[model samples]
Target: MTTAPGPAYRSAPTTFGAVARHGRAWLPVIGLTALASSAVSLALPSVLGHSVDAIVAGSGYGRWFTIAAVLIGVGVLCSLIDAFAGTACVAGTTAWLRHGLVSQVVRGGAEGSREFDSGDLVSRVSGNASDAAQAGPAAVTTVAATAPPIGSLVLLALIDPWLAVAFFGGVILVVGVLFVFARRTAEISLSYQQTQGRISALLTEAVTGLRTIASAGTTTREERRILGFLPELHRHGLETWKVLARSGAQAAIVGPLVLVAVLAVGGLQLVDGRITPGELFAASQYAVLGAGLGSLTGVIGEIARARAGIQRAAEVFAIDKVAHGLLPLPPGPGRLTFDGVTVVADDAVLLENIHLELPGGATIAVVGPSGAGKSVLASLAARLRDPSIGQVLLDGVPLPALNHHALRTAVGCAFERPTLVGTTVGDAISHDAIGPVRTLAAARATHAHDFVRRLPDGYFTPLPKAPMSGGERQRLGLARAWPASRLLVLDDATSSLDTATELQISKTLTEDRYRRTRLIVTHRTATAARADLVVWLDGGRVRGVGSHQDLWQDASYREVFG
Candidate 1:
C-alpha cells in the first residue's frame, strides 16, 4: 500500500540552523568560547605594538613583562575553550542526526514508501552525518575569523585613512573570489557525495552476492561494474580541487600585494612625521591581520562541503514516518478485517477490492497463485503496511489506531528468509521476549530447542560460530515470533522445512495455549487443507472464501499447487 508522502519531520535545512536546533545545549559554550577566542586574537597585535613603543622609549620593563604574560594567558585560555567547544558540538550533533536518521528508516518499515539500499543508508548515517556535524565548529570558526579583519580595518583607519582604504580594496577582491569558490565547490561536493554513495552501493551489492557471483563465474564482471563508479567520483573530486586552487592562488597573490601597499604608505607617513615609529609598526601588523582573516575563505569552503552533506542527510529526515492514530485497541481476540482495501505501487494496481471478515482464533490459510496479492494481504493484516484505499482492522479497531507497542505486541510475524540480529542464539530468540521461560517455550514449540541444545553451549553459543541450515534458521524465526499476544502472521515462513516438521509446527500453533488468529500465506495443498477456512486469491482479487475442501472443488484452485 502506498500514497503520497505526508509532511516531512525535520530540523532546519541549513547546516548551522540544524545544529542550533538539535544541539541547543552546546550553543552557549560555542558562542562564548568563539567570542573570547576572537577577542583575545584581536588584542594580541595591539598589545605587541604597545610593547614595541615601550621598548623604544626605554620604559620600565614591567610593562613589556605584563604584556607577555597577558598574551600567554589569553592564548592558553582561547585554545582550551576552542578545543572543548568544538569537540562537544561535533559529538552532540553526530548523535542527534544519527538518531533521527535511524528512527525514520526503521519506522518506515519494509513496505513503506521511503526506501534506500543498505549502502546508501549507511553512507547517510555515518559519512553524511559526520560531515553535517562540522556545522557547529565551522560557524564558530567563521565568527572567530571575522574578528581579525574587522579589528584591523578599524585600527588601520585610526592610524591612517589611506592604509584602511588600500586594505579594504584587496578584501573586496578576496571576498568575491570566495563567493565564487563556495558556489562552485557546492555543486562539485554534491556530485562527489552522490558518486561515493553509488560506489558504496555497488561494493555492498557485490559483497552480499559474492557467493552467487563466484558460482556464476562472473566475479570479474561484478568487480568491473563496481569499479566503474570511481572515474565519476574522481572527476567530481578534481573539480572541487580546481575551485580551491583558484581561490588559494588569488588569495595568496592579494595577501602580499596588500602587505606591501600598507608598508609603503606607512613608511612615507613615518618619514613625513605624520605618525610615530610605533604607529608605523601597528599599521604593518594590521595589514598582516587583514590578510590572515582572509584565510577564512578556507572556512567558507568547508561550509560549502558541509552544506552538501547536510543536504543529503536532510533528505533522510524528510521521509515521512508511518502515520499512527491516537486510538488504542482493547485487549481481546484478533478478529481481522479488511474493508475495501487496495494496494498499489508505481501506478500499478497490485490488490483491488479486498474485503474480508474473519473470526478470532481461526487458522485462515491465504492461498494464491503467483502474482496474487497473498503476501500483500498478510502484510496488511500485521500492519507491516497500510492499505492505500481502505482500512485493515483488528477487533474492529483500525491497525493504525493502535499504538506501536500495542500493535507490535499483538501481532508478530515470521518471514521465509529472516535476517536475525544477535550474537547468541538465546539473544536472537528472546530479543524482545517477556521472559526467558516464554522464550524457551516458543523455541520448543517451533522444534528448534532440540537442535539448539545440541550446539556446544546450548543456547549460549554464538550464532555465527554455530552453523545451521536454511530450515533451522526458519525455525528460529518462527520461534522468535511465537510470543505474539493476539495474532501471528507466517508469510511462507515454513517453506524451507520438511513436511513433517512443518505439520508439527502447525499442530503446535493450533493447540490451546497457542490459539490466536493466524494468517498463513502458503502454496502447499496440505497446509491449506488443514486450515479452518481458506481464502483463495487469484490475480489480486479474492476468488473464494470457504473450507479447503469447498475451494478444492474448483479446478483452477487445485492448479495453484500443481
Candidate 2:
C-alpha cells in the first residue's frame, strides 16, 4: 500500500532548551566574569564622586588620586576578562549549533523530502542558522551583564529614594517604548528572511534553466522576474531601521530628562543642609548608571529580531511526521508480481487493479497509449513509488517487506528520460560507480562505446558544451543500466535510438546471453513483437494479455493497434 511522505526534520526540544542544556557548563565562568566587570564599573563612578568631594573640601589630592587610578586599573582588568569570556562563549555556541543543525538535516533526510525546497533549505541552513548561532550567546551574556547594574540601582535607592524613584521610572518608560518598537522590528525581520529565501530559489531556478531561457530568447524576462522581489526586501530593511532610529531618539530624550529631574531634587536637598555634596555627587552618579542601563533597550531590540529568526529556523527541526520503515528481502533471482495494484498521482488513478506475475528469467513487454500508465506501473514494481492499493511482490516477499537497498540493486530500471550525474562519457556510462573494465563492456553492449571511443579522450571525453542530442544521452543511459544482476527494466529506453541500433540492443536483451527477468515498457510494435508475452493496458487498466499475434487478431486490440 502507498504511504504518505515524511517530514523534513524531527521534533526536537526548543532552541532555547537545547542552548541552555549545552551552555550550562560555561555558566559559572560567564557569571563570574560579568560580576567582576560590573563591580569594577560601578566602583569607578563612586570613586570619581569621592575625588570631586575631596577637591571641594580642599583635602590633599595625593590619596584620592591614587584611589581613582587603582579603580581605573581594576575596571580595565575586568573589561579584558569580560571580552575574553564573551568571545569564547559566542564561538563555542556557534560551532555547536551549526553542527547540530547539520546533523539534524542529515538524519531527517531533509534533502530527499518532496516538501523540502533545495534553495529554501539552503538559506535556512546557512544564513538563518548562522545568524541565530551568533546572536544566542551574546544575547544571553548581555542579560547576565545587566544584572549587576540592576543591583546597584537598588543600593542607590537606599541612599536617596527621590533620585532613585525618578531614575527607575524613566528606565521603565524607555524599556516599554523600546519593546513595542522591537516587536515591530522582529515581524519585519522575519518577512525579510522569507523574501531572501524566495530570491535565492528564483536565482537557482534561473541558473538551472539557463539553456531553456536562451533557446526561448527569454533571458531578459527571467532576469526581470528575479529582480522583482528585491524592492520588497529593501522596503522591509528600511522599516526595521526606521523603528530603530525612532527608538534611539526616544531613549536619547529620556536620558537627559531623568538626569535633570535627579539633579534638581538632589541639588535642593544639598542646599537645605540635609545632605553633603559627596552624597549629591553619588546620587548623580546613580542617575547616570540608570541612564546607561536604559540604553541597553536598543540591544534588546536586536535580540528580539534574532529570536524571531531562531524561531523560524527551529521549524526545520520541528517536523516529526516523516515515514521511515525498513523492509526485508529473501535471497533469489528477482521476480515481480502485482496483485490488484492501483497507482494514483495528482488526484487521478493512473493504474487500476493490475494483476500480473512474471516468473524468473522471463521477458515481458508492456504497451499502451501515451497516457495509459505503463511507465507508472513499472515505477511501482521498481519501488520508486508504492502502489496505492494491493500488493507488489518481489520474489516471495512483499515490496515493503524487502530490504530497500537490496531490492533496488536486484531490480534496476533505465527511465524514459534518464539523468546523468557526471560530465564525462565514461562517468555517465557506469553511473560513475563501476570500474573501467565493466564501464567499457557495458558501453559496447549498448553500442555507445564506438562514438565514445572516437571522442578526444575516448571514454573520458566530457559531455558537449551545449545540450547533447537526445539519442546520444539515451544510449549512455542504457549503458549505465546494462550492468544489473537479476531484473532489468527498460522504460522506453531505446526511444531515442535509430532503428538499426534499437534492433541490435533488443536482440542482445532478448537473446539467451543474459539470464535476467526483463520488463520492457514501450509503444513500438516491432519491439513488442520480439517479446515472449505482451500486456496491453488502456485507461489505467490491463485489457488483454497474450502473445503479439494473438492480440493482433483480437478486435479491441486491432482498434488499439490502428
Q: Total clashing residue pairs per candidate?
A: 0, 6
Model 1 scores a TM of: 0.94
On TM-score, the candidate that comes out on top is: 1
Tens-digit lDDT track for model 1 on 1-562? 3333222234334445765456566666767767776676666666777777777888964676687688779778867876887788788888888887788778767753246677888888888788788776787678667777888888889888988988888777777877788789878888888888888878888888888999999988998899998889888988888888888898888888888988888888889988877777878878877887557767787777678788888777666567666667786678998888888887888889888999898999999888899998988898777777888889988888777788888888999888877889988789674678988998998999979999999888998888988889999999888888899999999999988898898788766375799999998888898899899999899999999999888999899899
Candidate 2: TM-score?
0.79
C-alpha local distance difference test of each model: 0.81, 0.73
TM-score of each: 0.94, 0.79
- lDDT, candidate 1, residue 317? 67
CA lDDT, candidate 1, residue 43: 69
What residue pairs clash in candidate 2, if any at all?
A: 6-322, 7-322, 327-402, 327-403, 328-401, 328-402
Model 1's lDDT to the true fold?
Answer: 0.81
Worst 10 residues of 2 by lDDT: 1-10
**lDDT by residue for model 2 over 1-562, one digit each (tens)?**
4333221235565475465345554655666766776776666666677777788898965687898788778768766776676566656766676676566655554222345556776787777765565464456556665764576577567667776777777777666776777678778878888888888888888887898999999988998998999999999889888887887888788878877877888888788876668777877776777666656655565566556557766776664432333665666666788888877666899998888887777778998887888888777766666666777777877765655465656677887678876777777877537798999888888888867776778876776632456776787888888887778888988898889988998988888366787889987888889998888999999988989899988777766655
